[model samples]
Target: MKSRKFYISVFILFLSVFSVFGQTRKQLEEQRKKLNYEIKQVNSLLFKEKKKVNNALEDLNDLNRKISIRAKLIATINSEARILSKEIRVNETELKELRKKLADLKEDYADMIFKSYKSKSQQSRMMFLLSSQNFHQAYKRLEYMKQYTDFRKKQGEEIVHHSNEVQAVNDSLLVQKALKDKLIVSEKDQKKEIEVDKKHQEKLLATIKKKESSYKRELQSKVKAEKRVTAQIDRKIREEIERANRIAREKLKNAPTKPKSVKKNEFILSPEAKALATKFELNKGKLPWPVSEGIVVRKFGKQPHPSFPGITVNGTGLHIVTKQGQDAQAIFNGSVLNVLVSADGRKNVLIQHGNYISSYNNLEKTYVKKGDTVVTGQKIGQIFTDKVSKKTKLIFVLFKNTTRLNPSSWILRR
Candidate 1:
C-alpha cells in the first residue's frame, strides 16, 4: 500500500512535467516557423536585382535588424528544445521506477491473498472462536476477523490503484518521448534557418561594397524617371484645377443670387471635398495601400544617398514595390481628372478626391479616362516594371490644391 502511494505520487509528478514540456515545445515550433518565413522573404528580396545605391544603406540596415531578430528567435527556440529534452528524459526514468513498484506490489498482494486462503478453513475458524476463554473473547475474535477482511479488501484496492498509476505514467512517458522527437526536428530546422540568414547577411555586405559606382547611375536614372513622371502629373493637375475653377466660377456667375464671397483656391474647397479630406485625415494610420500586397521599398521625403556624401534625393510621394503584374487601385472615391503619359512613356492616371488629388504613375496602361468617376479601391491601371532592374515600382502621389503631401503619412505603413 505504501509503495502504491509512492508510485501514484511519481505518476502525478510525471504528468505535470509532460504537460509543461509539451506546451513549451509547441510555442518553440511556432516561433521557429515564423523566423523561417521571415528569413525566406529577406533572401528573396536580397537575390533579386542589384541593390539600389540610394536606398542600399537603409535597406541593408533594415535587413540587418531582421537578421538580428531571427538569430534571437532561433536561440530562444533552441533553448526551449533543450529544456524539453531534459524533461522527457526525466519522465522516462520516472516511468521505469513506477513500473517496478507496480510489479512488486502485485507480487506482494498475490502472496498475501494466497496465504489467507490457505490458512482459512470453515471448521477450524468456528472451533478457534469457541476455544476462546469466554463469550467476550469470542466476540472479540469475530471483530478481529472483520477487521482483517476489511484490511485485505483495502490492500486489493491499493494494488489496482497502483497498476492504473503505472499505466498512466507509461502513457505520459510515450507522449513526452514523441514531443522530444519533434523538438529535435525543430532544433535542426532552426540551425538551417540560421545558416541561411548568415548567407543573406554576407550577400548584403557584398552588395554594399560596390555602393559608390552603382549609386550614381541608379540615382541619375531614378531622378530622371521621377522628374518625367512628376512633370507630366503636375501639368495635368494644373489643367484640371484651372478647368474646375473656371467651371465653378461660371456656375456662380450664372446663378440667380450673387456670390457671398470668392477666395482664390477657396472655391476648390467644396463642402464635399473638405469632408473627404477630413475622412482621409481621420484614417491617417489606417489607409490601405494603392497596391494590395507589397512593401514600400521607397518612402516619401528627402533621403540621403546610400553611397556618396553631399547627395540627397527628394521624393514628392511614395514608391511602392510589388510583384510583377500587380494592379494599382484608387485609394478613395474620386473622378479621373486626367490620363496622360509621362515623358518616360509610362501611363499616368490622376483622380480628384474632392479638393485633393491622388496620382498613380508608372502604369503600363490606363483603364479609366478623364471625367470618369471612380469608387474607392477601383482598379485604374497596371504598374510597369523597370526592365533593367526588373523592379515593379509604382509612384503614388497625393496633392491638395496643387500642394504636394507625403503619401506615406496618409497611407498604411507596411
Candidate 2:
C-alpha cells in the first residue's frame, strides 16, 4: 500500500510535467510557423523591382533574424518532445505496475468480503466466544473481532484507492497520446517550412542570375542619362530663378517706396504659388502618380555600378516605367512653367507650384502648353516609349525654390 501511494504521487508529478511540456511545444511550433510565413512575404517583395533591390536586402536581413529565432524555437521544441516521450514511457511503466497492484488489491478485498459472509452466522459467533476460557480471553476475543472488522474496512478502502489510481493512469495515458499527436503535427509543419525556405533561396538565386548582367548595363546607361537630364534641368531652373530675381529687382527699383519689411535680397513668392504648394503638401500621401499604373525603375540617390567595377549612378528623382502610350499627368494643380525641347529631340514639361517645381521628362507630345493652368490628374503629355526596349519611362523630379529634392521622400512609401 505504501509503495502504491508512492507510485501514484510520482505518476501525478510526471503528468504535470508532461502537460507543461506539451503546451510549450505547441506554442513554440505556432511561433516558428508564423516567422517562416513572414520570411516568405519579405522574400517576395525583394524580387519585384530593381529600385527596391536594397529594400530586399533589408528584408533578407530580417529573414535571417527570424530564421535565427526559429532555430532556437525548434531546438526548444525538440527538447520538449524528447522530455514528453520519456515521460510517456515512464507513465506507461507506472500504469502497468498500477494495474497489477489494483488487481491484487481487488483479490484481497473479495477474499475479506467472502470470509466475512462465511463467518456471519450466530453459531459461528457463539463458538468464537466459547473458545475463550476466561473473562480476559473473551474480552481479547471481542477486541480481535473489532480489529478484524477494521481490517476488512481498510481492505475495501485500499481497493477504492487502487481503482481511483487506475482511472488517473488511464487519463494520463490519454493525455500522453494527445501530446504525441501534437508532436507529429508539429514535425510535419516544420518539414514543410524547411521546404519553403529552400524554395525561397532558389528563387533568390534565380533572380540574381537573371538580373545581374543586363541589369548592370541598363543601370549604367540610365545613370548617365539621368545625370545629363538633371544638369540640364538644374541649369534651366537657375536661369528661371535669375530671370525672376531680375524682374523683381526691376520692379523694386521702379516702385517709388518699397515696403521697409521687404528685403531686396529676398524673393517673395506669389500668392497663387504659395497656395498651390500648401495644397500639395496637404495631400502628401494622396498625390497622384506621374504616370498611372507605372513601376518605379530608377530611384533617387547614388547607386553602385551594376556591370562595371567601381562605377556608380546618381539620380535626383525617380524614373517610372509604364505601359506604352500612357499619359504623364500633373500630380497636383499647377501652371506649366516651361516646355523643354532637348537637343536630342526629347520633350519635358515643367510645372510650378509657388516656390516649388515638378518636371516630367521623356514625353513624346505635349497636351498642355506653357502657362496653361492644369488641374490635379490632368494629362500634360504622352510619355515616350523607348523603341529599343519597348518601355515607356518618365523621369519625374521635384524642386523647392531652385534646390532639388528627392521625389521618393515626398511620395507615399508604398
Candidate 3:
C-alpha cells in the first residue's frame, strides 16, 4: 500500500521532467535543422559563383557567414546531448527504485496470503471473533479483517503498476540514447565544415593581397556610386517637402475663412495620409522585406571596412544583395513620386508614404512610374546586377520630412 504512493510520485516526476527537458530539446533540434538549410543555400548560391568572377572579398564574407552558422548549430547539438543525458540518468534511477519496491510489495502480499489461508475456515473465524470479551470488541475484530483484505488487493495492484513503469522507463532510455548518438554525428560533420571554410577564407585573403591597389580602386568606385544615389534621394525628399509646404501656404492665404501659418520641413497632409502615417509607425519592426529573398551586404551608418584598417564606409541605407533578375518590391502602400535615373543610367523609384518617403534604387528597369499608387509587395523594379562583379544589389532609403532614417530598423530582420 505504501509502495503505491511511491509509484504515483515517480510517474508525476517523469511527466514534469518531460515537459521541460524533452520539449526544449525538441525545439532546439528543429531550429538546428533550419540553420543547416540556410547554410546549404549559402554554399550553393553564393560560394558556387566564384568561377565567373574574381570577387575574393565577397567570397570571404560569405564563407565567414557560413562558419558562424555552423558554430551555432554545433552549440545546439551539444545542448541536446546534455539534456538527453540528464533525462537518461533520472530514468535509470527511477527504474531501479521501482524494481526494488515491486519485489518488497510481492513478498508482503505472499506473507499475508499464507496467514489468511490458515484462518480460511468459518469455524476458526467465528471462534476468533467470539473470543472477544464484549460486542464492541467483536465488531472491532471484524473491521480488522476487512482492512487486511483491502490492503492485500491494493498491494497486488501496486505491483502491476510499478512493473509497467519500469518497462516504460527502459524504453524511454533507449530513445534518449539514440538521440544522443545522432547529435554526436551531426556535431562532427559541422566541425569538418568549419575547417573547410577556414581554408577557403585563407585562399581568398592571399588573392586579395596580390591585387591590393586594384581592389582598393574598385571599392572606391562602389562607394562613389552609393554616395551619388544617396544625395539624389535627400535632394528629392527636400524638394517634395518644399513643394507641399508651398501649396499649403497658398491654400491658407486664399481660404479667407481662416488664414494659418505653415511650418518649415512640414508637408500638407490629407486625412488619409495622416491615418497611413499612424499605421506605419505602429508597424515598425514588423514591415515586410522589399525583396522576397535577399541578404544585407552593407548595413546602415558608418562602419570600418573589413580590408582597410582605418577606412570606413558611410552608409545612408541598407544594401540588400540578391540573385540576378530578382524584383524589388514596395515595403508599404504608397504612391510613386519620381523614377530618377543616375548618370550611368541606373534607375531609382521614390514612393511617398504619407509625410514619409522610401527610395528603392540600383534598379536596371522600373515597373512603377510617377504618380502611380502601390501596395505592399508590389513590384517596383528589377534590381541592377553588375556584369563585372556578377552582383545584384539594391540601396533602400527612408526619409521623414528632411531627416533620414535607417531602413533596416523598420523592416524584418531576416
Candidate 4:
C-alpha cells in the first residue's frame, strides 16, 4: 500500500508536467504557423516587373522577419523536445517500479494459495477451530482465517492492477520518444532554413553596400512617396471637415431646435451617427486592420527609420506594406464619405463613423462611393502597388472630426 501511494504521487506529478508543457507546445506551434504564413505574404509582395532590381530594403526587412520567426520556432521545438525527454524518463521509472510491485504482489498471492491448498479439508479447519481453549479463542481463530482469505484476494487484484499500469507506462514511453524524434527533425529543418535566409540576406547587404549612394537615393524617394500620401490624407480630411461644417452651419441657420453653440472638433451628427460613433469609440484598440495580411512596415506617429540613420519619419497613420492586389476592408460600420484620388492617381476611401472617420489611402481602385453605407469588414477598395519599386504600402489613418488620430492605437495587433 505504501508503494502504491508513492506511485500515485509520481503519476500525478508527471500529469501536471504534461498539462502545463503540453499547452505551451501547442501555443508555440500555432504562433510558428502564423509567422510562417505572414512571411509567405511578405515574400509575395515583390512585384514581377522584369529588368527592375528588387527593393533591397524591403527584401531585407522580410528576410529579417523570417529569420526572427524561424529562430523562435527552433527554440520552441527544443523546449518541446526537452519536456518529452523528461516525460519519457518519468514514465520509464514508473514502469520499473510498477513491475517490481507486481512481482511482489504475485509472489505473496502464490504463497497464500499454497497455504490454502495445504489445508485441504473444511472439516480439518473446523476441528482446529473447535479445539480452541475457550469461546474467545475459537472466535479469534475464525477471524484470522477470514482475514487471510480476504488479504490473498486483494493481493491478486493488486497484481493485475499493477501489471496494467506497467503496460500503460510502456506505451506512454514509446509515444514520448516518437514525439521527441519529430521535434528534433523539425528543429533541424528550421535551423537549415535560417542558415539559407541569412546567406541570402548577406548577399543582399553586399549588393546594397556596393550601391549605397543609389540605395540611399531610393530610400529618400520612398520616404517622399510616403509623405506625399500622408499629405493627401490630411488635406482631404480638412476638406471633409469644411464640408461637414458647411452642412452644420446650414442646419443651424434653418432649424428652430438648434443647440446654443457647435462643439469644437466634432461634426454635427444625427442620432444614428452619434450611436455609431459611440460604438466605434468603445472599440478602440480592437479595430480590425485595413488589410487581411500585411506587416506594419511603418508605424503611426514620429519615428526613426529602420535602416537609415539620423533620419526622422513622421506619419499620422499606420503604414501596412502588403502583397500586390490586396483589398482594403472597412474597419467599422460607416458611410463612405468620399472616394478621392491623389496626384499620382492612387485612390483613397474615407468612411465616416459619426464624429469619427477612417481613411484607407493609396488604393488602386475604389469599390464604394460617397454616401454609400458599408458594414464592418466590407471590401472598400484594392490597394495600389508601385510597379517601379515593387512596393505595395497602405496608409491607414483615423480621425476624430478634424483632429488626426494615430491609427496604431485603433488597429488590432496582428
- Tens digits of per-residue lDDT, candidate 2, 1-414, equal 122332353345434434434456567557546545544443333223334124222233333333443444455456567767877888889889999998988888788788778787545866898888999999999999999989888888888888898899889888877977776777677657645654554454345446556655665676687678778888887777667667755766767766244333233555565687898788766677787665565587777532234667676679776767889999888888789998778899999876678899989999988789988889999999765445577989888777778887677654
Residue pairs with clashing backbones, model 4: none
Model 3 lDDT tens row, 1-414: 122332354345434434323448778778778778778766655655545656876666666667666766777777778888988899889888988988888888888888788677545777889899999999999999889879888888998998888889889989889988988998898889778776776677778778878888888888887677677767777787787667766766766565334466766776688888888888899889888887777788999775654567987888887778999999899899788888889998988888778889899999989989999999999999887667788888777767778988899876
Candidate 4: tens digits of C-alpha lDDT, residues 137-248: 9999999989977987788788888888888889888877887888888778878887898788777767767777787788788779877766767777777777887887
lDDT of 1 by residue, 1-414 (tens): 122332353345434434333446567667666666655555454345664433554555455545454555546565576776777688778778878887887788789888777767535678879889999999999999899889889878887887888788778767767876776776677568656655665565566565656756776787787676677667767777878878866776766765555444433555676787788677776767899866555577888543344567777888777777889999988788888875657888888877778889889988899999998888999999766556777889888768898887888754
Q: Name model 2 segments beyond 4 Å from true.
A: 1-222, 252-267, 306-309
lDDT (Cα atoms) of all candidates against the true structure: 0.71, 0.68, 0.78, 0.76
Ranking by TM-score: 3, 4, 1, 2
TM-scores vs. true structure, each candidate = 0.57, 0.48, 0.81, 0.79
Q: How accurate is candidate 2 locally (lDDT)?
A: 0.68
By lDDT, the better pick of 1 and 3 is 3
Off by over 4 Å in 4: 1-23, 43-52, 120-153, 252-264, 321-323, 388-393, 402-413
Give each prediction's root-mean-square deviation over alpha carbons.
Answer: 13.2, 17.3, 11.2, 10.4
